[model samples]
Target chain A: MSVEVEVNENDLAEMVEQVWESYLDPEGINPLIPTYDENQPSEVHSSVSISGSWTGHIVYACSIEAARRAAAAFLAMEPDEVSQEDLSDVLGELANIVGGNVKAMLPPGAFLSLPQVVLAPESTARFPNTERISGVYGIWDGEPVSISMWHSRADNNQEDGA
Target chain B: MTLSQPEFAFVSTLVRKEASIVLAPGKEYLVEARLIPVARAVGAANVNEFLAELQRRPNPAHQRKIIDALTTNETSWFRDREPFAALTDVILPELIKSRATTRKVRFWSGASSSGQEAYSLAITLQEALPSGWNYEIVGTDISTEMVKRAETAEYSQVEVNRGLPASQLVQYFERAGAHWRVTSQLRKNVSFKLMNLTAPLPAMQPFDVIFMRNVLIYFDVATKRTVLQNVAKLLRPDGWLFLGAAETTIGIDDNYERVAAGRTSAYRVRTGVPAGASRRG
Candidate 1:
């Protein structure tokens, strides 16, 4: 008895804003403006999977400079003091948070998987058997950060009912 | 630009007068990091402009925001894994044995920020304690904003993602629109209030366990001693006290002695103190 969950571009925008305000910045002033740049290269990438009611993947990719600055703010340290491990952890956590929220919108029984991180320079993640459904791209602290949702197409006959 | 000496001093002084939290010189970066966004929110270009405006004319609402911003520490479910382990493995087993006659237990979360710690305790009791056993948890914080948020008992996904395992979440919480709310089964056993540790405390029932962790770092030496003294008054003579890994009662208070509890250490009133010595009803 699983129903469709509608997640539009606006939904993605709002989810990113909520995550940033709650964790990365308390004051909620550092807003992320929506942008469009698919080919933008990122130094760090992370993702999480959703299963059960609806199946999909939520991907979070950001430039190294952006990752470092975010880690610094999160730990309340200087940007230069941020280590590569810290950057990876922060990015992975962000993806988990965003993915967890998106999972909540779907029907009951949806479960979010553990977050995974890829640390190669100028790297991007690709999820097999899934197509990019919707995404939000934005500039945070003058660096690129993107959150995109992909739907699994394992069963072509199933309607993308949302 | 960074926060100037005058700006930092202004914020530090205000925070001290209001909340009694000392912001030392090295904390300039912290002030800037926290207050810069606040400044922008109030229409100021930067921290400097925000302080200048506040100095020219004080606004209680604006100042309250500053205090909340600085005092709002990051919190997560079962934050710092070892402490919760201590609760589950060491502290509760001992307490359950001692309270066999009463079949009840009480806990106090002295610095519960947004109610995670208190709820976590409730969930633990639900899963660990035997049937027919009853428990209660009281959460107190100095910030009014935090107290209100705690009372709501709702948390965003980002808030819950921090250190909360998915299994515990699905079992203890139910979805509320876009957020999650604590199940009434757990919520009924927990309550939250606004109280300042640096100030005189109100009458309260003695607790079997007191979690006053990670908050002593904000207070000066004298204030820390006083807070511990206040807590000791409300704790049963043999009750357990858990402080942050970095905090201790060895040098601050002599009434308590530290003992090992699995991966962490807990404090209990020193020997020679009569049983129920400080227990108030």
Candidate 2:
């Protein structure tokens, strides 16, 4: 079984863009544009873990305004009507959908853990013994957002080279 | 105005205490957007203003509306493919054989958002059961708002697009304005009501099958065990219980033993008999 494999950043950004265009914004005039920086600040974060073939985490983080916009788009309500719980669920679901798609690209037999949402001013979503493998940041509807992967640190000691 | 850190933490504690849905730290952005409405309803300008008012007084009604908005989910017909397949090929057949003598069977669809799962079960039953046999499906959820939506039995195209197939679309749903309304025949076999899974359950008729898929994941371990224990009482000894693919009874509860059928898994309640005595039987 392979432990560490190359996680292409463009591939993740493209998938996130596709999800945004298809589900979140049908009229995606300002499409997601990739950023060179990976450490994007976020007020809301939703993440899911992928196990089995690859042990890693998929994280989606965005600003509060951006989070509300996503929730408003998801629930088809005015941004004002979207609630705190709705924000968590929308972000969590976004992570789940994007994470599920990412899992399919991993080795056969990979499974996704149920998504968990976090609302901290400072949020860090690192799975046990895992470090950043590939990260992609982008701008969505004028708000900063990113989707990144973290592979197990054990992979370095045991399996080496990506 | 954007929600501040402390206010976010405050709302998190409130919802977790009330609903059992974990809004982990750093998830403050979630309810911040939704609280705009809540603030307005309570005569405040924003969530911050509402927080100030909440300190002075308690408004349970607006609090519930806030939770409902946050937790309500958009569901679709056959939301997950494998569960439905298990129902069509394995669970239903087993129940039909065991309950044939009674000519009646019942089902409970827990967290049945907007009646999709409940009606989906009804459709499966109508298709598989011998004609003229009696059957019913009862759906329950925590949100009364969602319960009302389920009662209406209508869905939008976006909702239908999620998992509903074209053939099932034509057969079971009739055109209603821009949305699709479940045909009257299917509606009769299903009903919806507000029931919280975290609370102790009311005594009810035992069911031949109970679908609590994807719902158990929302609660904590203790709530999961309580809900499953209640399920044990509601399900007939021979009845089937279906859970989300990711969820299991392994450590939470031991009353159910996994049974694999076709491409999916369903569980049956273990007989109270001791391990050694069961081997003799």
Candidate 3:
């Protein structure tokens, strides 16, 4: 059911901060809360959706350069040698794993969907009933990267026992 | 600090060229996690030192350790018990009848980590078949360490707990302090060997059933295809292929058609081809 854990803005920020610190370099810049940019490349965002006790999604949205950099960091490879498909896979898997781990903290018996890479941030806008948790993380290279978590309100209602 | 472009490229190239393994981007941590222990075991101070040694002169033993470390040994006895039960009741009965024509039944446990699966099959066959029923159980893994462990037939308490009924454990294993050892009779019916699924098929007789469960997720598309083809080559016509619950051959290989047996789904190699044709009919 739609069981809200009373997660405050501070807690959300803390979760994002911890995830970025542990998953990426610990010395990277603190993550900023959700803010959207229209000028960024429409083809740069990748996200993974996980459905378990709570149906939710995690997105790793950034520029082409940032995606390449994130892929390099995740795969422990050079950015120059990282192929587009490799970057897509790396980002998608990162989102999936992060989403899965976060979902584990939320509730048990949650089923994580396979990760998918997409072209536009707004593509996610197709799901209007999703509760969005968004943040912007700064990397050691001083580049701002955006990450978001979405939970479908409809799915939550469906999960309700009553 | 993040690895430079050259360093990442170098490592990726080394993984592909030397190990003949493809490292998916997200799996870099897996490489690091698996190799760090191996590097330490080989007395290398760090991954850099290990890589340096690998580059200068690749020791076969060290290479083997790396492969062994990379293999994910997540396995359980009678994992997804329905299949094994089905094998005991339905599949084995039919196979025994069919194989009676030849007076032999051969089963293979591909990706058989530490021998529980093969031994499980052997014990089931031993219990189900009449005395002196001729059957051979073969367990194979890419990791020599795993093969060795499987041959030893000794399992930790935790390992024995997973999917192994107390009744079966008591019957098949002798208490070895903290560990359980498969009885000599069970161990005698099974053989453990080292095999890489990506490589050519080993020279062996065709198997009536193959259990290659839960290990395919690590491979990319090409590797999966190659492995499936090789596995198909070793499977007898109408042989069964039991995969993990979450795994399938739908997009990966078409040589085997999915067959539903009660609650479980396994694959059967397509028949009706020329006897010598390599591809499934």
Candidate 4:
């Protein structure tokens, strides 16, 4: 029997919150909210694929507004002054850092793919055998935002034998 | 004048043709970020105005800054970990054994940025190798400003935080007010030089190992092939080449074959030929 310990929705939410608080900004200006729907949510997202002893993908997805606000807050710029590419880079770096930390929590020897940003949630669908873990929270501006994590069990099973 | 897609495209194409550096499609922001500040400093109103002025009268100083900014300096001591561990455990031991007969070992870092990678290697050698072993470390980069910084060996907090562990930092660096300077002993083993990889390498002794990581990604396939061939010429037949984790020589060049030591992938020049023949081969 293979034991796969997956991060829970709440734990994933806390991880995202902690990452944003520590790495991005301390003012807690752009708090991430975690939300889920019976149907998959449609939103802007960034993700990094983790491989090695245990293999999977970690994704950070949220609304466009939340992403823009987060980018502005992270860069310490007015929202209007933030460009789309800058927002994408900020979000991508966020996903990379959070994914890197999460990779540390997994069994040692996980390889991380370069981080990527996408326009919508469908982007995360490219990776196979994904399970979504998600949560919701309120920003300092009282905007509702969501954070989600996804893992692929297939990749984990392959690494177990190697 | 205002910045436009065509202008960005022109600059990207020129860089690719002249230097063989690849500027991926979405990286226009990087170009704009580097050029805008230089433009303002040169009294241009905007990026377009700067480009127009640059076209009308190309100032070497402004051009140098643009190139410096465009070059990515993402490096850290003992970056990616496994390679350095392998260097310490396997490569260095073999090199030491071989060099014992000759009494000297030489190493080069082809794209050393701000001296972190080169100094890291030096520290590793000092810690791992036997006392009184003779070794030389030479570092070179295209940016004059970066080479100057490397020569000074001082680093900011943000620069030091990347991959440097606190213990290593304490052992290797002398703290000044808010910055840290690499000790003279470590600095003594290595020398920094300004070199554009697109140009021919300087007259230097053959090297047992060359750490040319990460920089290859910037170059085009032809440039990669040319650079690897040039590197192979400079490398002793048994010497090793270390590339970034994401980089590989498989498709780009065949002059050097990949060799594995533990988890790290390194390259060695194909054997059974004289150094001159290998360069021609």
Please say which candidate is ahead in lDDT: 1 or 2: 1
User: Where does model 3 exceed 4 Å of error?
Assistant: A1-162, B1-35, B38-73, B274-281
lDDT, each prediction: 0.82, 0.76, 0.69, 0.72
At residue B244, candidate 3 shows an lDDT of: 73
TM-score (all chains, Cα) for each model: 0.63, 0.54, 0.51, 0.55
Write candidate 2's Cα lDDT for A19-138 as tens digits: 775677654444667776777787778889877767778888888988899899899999999999999999999999888877756766677889988886424433567777767787
Please report, as a residue range, the 10-residue window in candidate 3 chain B with the lowest summed lDDT: B272-281
Instruction: TM-score winner between 1 and 2, please give it.
Output: 1
Instruction: Indicate the docking level reached by candidate 3.
Output: incorrect
- List, residue by residue over B66-85, the lDDT tens digit for candidate 4: 55556544656787788889
Q: State each candidate's chain A TM-score.
A: 0.86, 0.86, 0.71, 0.76
Where model 2 places Cα greater than 4 Å from the true spot, the runs are A1-162, B5-31, B34-74, B273-281
Per-residue C-alpha lDDT of model 3 across residues A31-140, encoded as one tens digit per residue: 33344442333346666666646676777666667677767777788889889898788778767755654554564466666777874553557557787654444443
Please tell me what DockQ candidate 4 reaches. 0.02
Model 1 per-residue lDDT tens digits across residues B1-281:
88888888899998887666898898887788788768887799888888899899976557866886787545688877787888889888988899999999999999887899999888888988889899999999877878899989988766778788899999988887567899999999999998988778998999999998877755666777888888888888889899987788878777788999889898988878753243322
Where in model 4 is the C-alpha error above 4 Å? A1-162, B1-31, B38-46, B49-73, B276-281
Candidate 1 structure quality by residue, lDDT tens digits, A96-137: 988987887877677788998888543323677777778888
Docking quality class, candidate 4: incorrect
What's candidate 1's DockQ score? 0.16
Of the native A-B interface contacts, what share survives in model 1?
Answer: 0.16
Query: Which digits, one per residue and each the tens of the lDDT, describe model 2 over residues B71-119?
Result: 6444657866787888788777877788778888899998777888898
